[model samples]
Target: MPEAVIRTAPSPTALLASLDPLLRQWLPRRRWFAGKGRPITGLTPVAVTELPSPAPDSDGAPGALTGLYHLLVRVHQPPAPGSPERPGDCYQLVIGVREVPPTRPAPGLIGHVTRGPLAGHVVYDALDDPRPAGVLLEAVRCGARVGPLRFDRDPGHEIRTGLVPRRMTAEQSNSSVVYGDRLVLKVLRRIGPGTHPDLELPLALARAGCARVPAPVGWMTAELSGDSWLLGVLQPYVQGAVDGWELALRELSKGEDFAAEARALGRATAEVHTALARALPTVTLGHRAMARIADGMSGRLAEAVRTVPALLPYAPGLRSAFTALGDLAGQGRTWTAQRVHGDLHLGQCLRSPDGEWSLIDFEGEPDRPPEERRMPQPAVRDVAGMLRSFDYAARSADTPVPGWAETCRAAYCSGYARVAGHDPRTDPVLLRAFETDKAVYEVVYESRHRPDWLPVPLAAVRRLAAPGPARLMP
Candidate 1:
């Protein structure tokens, strides 16, 4: 089959008027489109590509295109002062177009067409549009078969696919359409030239038998085409699960003792760390990496201290703690580096209905550079993250309860020590140092994004200053 000439042009209403109804159905329903909830003032098609056509249409239609087609759309919005500039805010829609017939309905395609830009364009969700879903699914499934797409961590096993494209719940950052029960296809709205951490790290962890993470089934790479698109990620669907943040809040609200559960979570995290150490090549956390981590905390602390004047009083002590930690780098008290889950907050963990915890979403902190995110760091970084979460849970409660924080901390540390074989007491100074650094990071995080939550980290900083006697574990 001759390759259709890949082309680029601005698409006006007139151009869309002549296209298939299916095309119109898809353009509006996508999450990557800027005009998701608003009217599209105008649209300019930045680029387009022709994919191999799927098998012939069942209806015997002549000259019907059945291959994957990519569209880059710039959506115009009402001008407003001080609004942050985002590609999605202007480029309202990105559609991965493909042609399919009515007879073959792709799996995972039926759902409500909620309020959004697409609702006015099409009465139903795009997956409900029979033609487009079938075309995209055929392309995804076929792409999986084309070659041995090795898992990043375990290259020995090739990726297998049985993705059925379905409409996804609305998300803020990217467009997600599930591929059957096996994988999720997340098409990024913004254009960037780096590998998405969401796709890369989870696949690496899963390949390493990090059972807590979703296994990568396949992924669609749109790099070579120069469009700066993340076609989609195919991952195993974790069934009957609740997000860990919600679960933690629920447990805390119910007056249930979470010590045992916290300990279990610690163990699960240790398992993840063990897998990471085994699967990926390790690096020593030398001066450069330590300085980078310290510098990040120091920078955020400075900004936070300035913004929330309340933090200023504690600034001197915080600076001393950070400097002491940084000084350890020169003493050769280095940590082994391994791939870590960049973002380890409660929201990133999923608890199955059976009460088992599974970590989801290996996309590290969103603000960090891709290369920095991929770089190995001390496993304790994740431990420090979870510890901070425990403190947050304690502080945000309606009434301050005695022993709640201590109990949870002990449980978590116990589980971690059991698996990682590190005694928390012996390393109390180091552990507390890392914890203080994490709290400082949160101080800035909450100040900038959620000013209301500033008290959470501020209280933590106070607690860190009053050093407590280390409790020796049996």
Candidate 2:
């Protein structure tokens, strides 16, 4: 056990209670925090453990002070009227306590601690401190089991130590730190007692000999009361790689064709889907199952319309898409359901300079429950998400590129058909419903987070709801 884990001076419960006020104010503001717009009524500590310090200095001397702690706090928020009662969400936090502020200003500073175990300390998100980030990677490299936290690495890979850490800034639902171009560690902000798809899917794909996704190099987990919760994952960092979203926007700016790149991405997606089907148990969703899924989509649309009145005009058309899905089920249609990248988009993909594409971030819609995200679903759901992403990129340009999205969409489907032996366009009903569902989600997300971006998805909503036969391209 590390020295930090052995200390017992600060009671975890007491520490959490004292920091309640600061946490309530800080948690909601975080991009990763899910309970935005809802006022936090309270925070109950579920589990807390001290973390190890950074490695020794260059001369092998002692390291900095041990002020980092791993915390899982359940946040309680007042529910909306008629909403089902449920336990509050649990968020994983890495906090650092310093006697004084860092030499340079840092993010996530929650002001000085006026009370608590260390009354005179300054508290901030520990990940912003390189020392704590290095400690996490070191623990993973050594496969350390400290207190309730377990750090493990794949036996096939050896992680090098002393890599400098720089936090990634573009992430919205999780905090990722890149370690000197070798590895990137993604610390999941919201945690629950289940195997997160972010770690599980990658490992499974690696086992199935799939190279379209990065293999996990190391991971972290927490054990509390005989249950395991996934905390973080470390994977190889694709150096000199640009994400698909950025690539799309750049190409659009120069009036360049992105069909070839989109086609390759589709092939990559198909490969991942094939591997997932082989690695995990798959099922055939029959009439009842498909109907239930359609009902859920309709229910979500109803809720979204209520939340964003702007969706009202397209409600009837959107409902027709879902209705077509249910009608298919009524006609005894069945589709294969397997574990998929629950939420897929261009942003979740990385394109190397060599033009090879690799998929990342399988955590799914952060707002959805963990178990729901882990459930089996039609692979077309991912295909639909990518399609919406194409439209979004095209519309996001200063001057919307006409036919750019359509050309890319056709090329992508053709590429997928080459690998999977079937094009997603062949299932127009399922594709339209899933794409509509994705647009509805985007509408709600933009309405709440970025009103300026609302028109992008709204454009898709109008096209998707246009009265006509379901087609491959809008």
Q: Highest TM-score, which number? A: 2
Candidate 1 per-residue lDDT over residues 234-331, each given as its tens digit:
55566667776666677778777888778888888888888888877898777767767777767767766765677778887776666766788767
Residues 1-474 of candidate 2: C-alpha lDDT, one tens digit per residue: 354444432587898977888898888778777667778988998888777655433454332334788889999997632246689999999887777666442756876777868577778887887777888898898888877888999989988866989888796788999998999999998889977899999999999999999999999998888988899999999999999999999999999999999899889999999999999999999999999999999988998898789899889988999999999999998999999998899999999989899999999998677888999999999999999999889988887788999998998999998999999998989999999999998988887667789999998898888887543455
lDDT of 1 at 437: 73
lDDT of 1 at 40: 51
Flag clash pairs in model 2: none
Q: Which candidate wins on lDDT?
A: 2
RMSD of each: 7.9, 2.5
Please give each candidate's TM-score.
Answer: 0.68, 0.94
Worst 10 residues of 1 by lDDT: 145-154
Query: What overall lDDT, based on C-alpha atoms, would model 2 receive against the true structure?
Result: 0.86
